[model samples]
Target: MFVKISHLYAENFPQLTAPFRPIWGPKASILLVDDKLAAQLNLSPDEILAALQSDDVAEKTVAMLYAGHQFGQFNPRMGDGRAALLGEVSGQNGMMFDLHLKGSGATPYARGGDGKAGLGPVLREFLMARAMAALDVPTTGSLAVIETGEQIWRDVPQPGPVPGAILVRSAASHLRVGHVQYIATMGDDALLSRFIEYVLNRHNMRADAHENMALSLLQNVMERQAALIAKWMSIGFVHGVMNTDNMTLSGETIDYGPCAFLDEYNPASVFSSIDRRGRYAYGQQPAIGGWNLARLAEAMLSIIDDNVETAIEKAQSVLSGYTALYDAAWRDLFAQKIGLFEVHKDDGDLIKELLTLLAKHRVDFTQFFAELGPIFLGEKKRDADNFAAGHFGMDLAVWYEWKNAWQSRRDLESMDEIRILDVMRRANPLRIARNHHVEAAINAYIYKGDDGPFKALYAALSNPFEQREEWDIFDAPPQMNSPPFQSFCGT
Candidate 1:
């Protein structure tokens, strides 16, 4: 029983409305579905499938209107061109979740583009979103993927049209900062107020005073975003397109377009083909995150206070706190990565030094941290030596010096070695959704119509922290001489 949740967004802002159009040649064959999430939502696989396949579902769906700042430029109108909010489901935990369908069909905001998705991008989002969840990063979860049995043209380096698919993406809420910004730009104070109240109630956030509701919401979103971005940085995840529209107010990592995990520890790594200027690089994520939050703050100004000067000051104060919140989160996570139970003044410096060394030597980001667990636990000296030699090559002397300094700090902490090693094991994942492996899987599925690689990669990434013999190959980085890998927005 899918309950329509009052259609609060559409009811509040009728001007920003569009109806969902049915998928062309809709053949809903399930490619991937999350049984775990299904159970959480109290829906069986068959029931979920039945509901999705129902003809009425398309008619009931709504495509939302919004705007975004793309590549530091504001586009005043960009909405769900190819996606639709099917309906909302109340989870077992009493939390409200939205089931949005990507590649559903055409919407009013299609803007001359086909309202469809390629199989590769759908599979990529499913894999990457689940992998992020396993790594304890807050992210939207894929409920199911249904192959549409249609071909969609894409601008991939390859020549032909690719197979189309629809991804059932579940999120705490699909509302974005851009949505609020859109309402604010309309100059409709009543609609903006209703939207803010809807968000606060939906997210279960409370405000002490009516006058402070917007400021309170802004504070909550900022704190969650700070912690969320820190989690992404700790795991080497680059949200390649950090546009305001892509930044979900629910604090979960949303869109997977052009997103990738770092292989070699270069802060300036750019995977998104469209990011020619490297605006959303790995290291720049925090700064970009702050910039997005500033946009949110700007949108909330009128709601925060009636006086323009007062509202700007209030927003500025909150925006200024983002740096401290981000820095503290980064420090704590980096500390955990290095197996430090307690923070020391020099811990930040030590962490920076290690990252500097990794960057200089071009070490694999996942492997470097994963290998450290065994070395710190004294399980494999030979492997540790080989890893050191492999990473440092002729520069073993400096590597050894850094290793010695790190060990000295560990020793000085007097923390139980077993406890420290346990933290390290949990902090360092043995496998990530590696770009090369993901590409190989996509290639297998797209060209050969084989899903073996896709399934295997999903299984390996499902439990990335575990050391499993079957997944050992997934841990290795791609060959150094392999062709440079690039990702696209899959639009």
Candidate 2:
């Protein structure tokens, strides 16, 4: 059965998008299907393939247009260069998600390069996005991956041709901060207002009696982004790239290129090979998030208020609140990880001290917290040996000292032992899509045409909080003295 795809964005804002058809390679085949998401949408792989092959959906496909600040420098013209928004579908949850096709070939924004995606990157996004979703992080979702029966030539990460592929991605809406920036920068005031209204309506963020619509929208976006970044920090996920275009107004994580989870607890960890300056390091995420929101605030300043001075003041007020929102969320999340259910004002100090200890000892970020549940419940010993293997040259006494301090704090709050263990288990993941594992899975599939390892890894990542003997291998981090992990943009 053919599932109808709504032309919501295209029919309403035709000027903001260019109609296009996907240029699929010969012998295109479905490489993977998100069966869970497919069932939610009442769709099947055959139906999805049929729709793409049919002219109806292809005719409705469009390449979005918007400009953005790439790495602090403004790129006046940029959009879906290698991708097309096929249309929209309503899920059982009654939310409209855009079905976007990546690596579908070039459009006007392709600039001069070929609008194709390497299979490695397509699979990378497929795994990363799904892993994030299961981890309870708000993100764009992958629907399917289709092999294009073609080759993509690239030099970085390796010097050879790789197989080409397309990923069908689903998101709440592809309306990015850059979308509003485009209209405002072009002096199209009327279009900007229309677009803003469209977004407000889509997200059910109508202005209340106390606030103007544009100002309310800015505040709403700021709040979402603050919460989103805190979630990313809670798990040790580094987005690698934080460009304005990649910052969705929907506040979901997008553009998974070079993204990775931390192995060691260093705040300064950076895995993106292109991030030599560490602009988007693990610790810098919160600040960069605020920086990106500031860009959006600047773009919407005109509609925020009639008077320029008044608009700046109003936008500044909303921007000022981002730090506090992020701080509170970060503190609360970290508190949960350490079994401090009732967050105290001074809890920040405790969190900071433990992180400092982990960093000083080069401890595995995920393992230290994950092992806490069993150790606290008496299922595993609470001695220094439990954490000794993950770090080196550490005073065993310091471990006991930190544990005593943590226990004292929990006792001060009158926290129950079993309840604290439950909270810690929920807050900390037993397994994560570690960098070495992800790289190994990608290498296996790309070189040997093997999906067994990739499938197994995804299955383990899907149930990160659960204890499974079969997935115990994923709990291990990459070994010390191994080469530092690096990821490429796969552009």
**lDDT of candidate 1 over 294-395, digit per residue (tens):** 998888788778899999998988788999999989999988888887878898898899999999999999888888878757587658778888888989
Q: Please, what is the whole-model Cα lDDT of each candidate in the order they appear?
A: 0.85, 0.86
Best of the candidates, lDDT: 2
Off by over 4 Å in 1: 1-15, 209-211
> What TM-score, over all chains together, does every model reach?
0.96, 0.97
Q: Estimate the overall C-alpha local distance difference test score of candidate 1.
A: 0.85
Error of 2 at 43 (Å): 1.6
Q: After superposition, how far is residue 283 of candidate 2 from its true place, in Å?
A: 0.8
Model 2 regions more than 4 Å off? 382-385, 388-392
TM-score attained by model 1: 0.96
Best by TM-score: 2
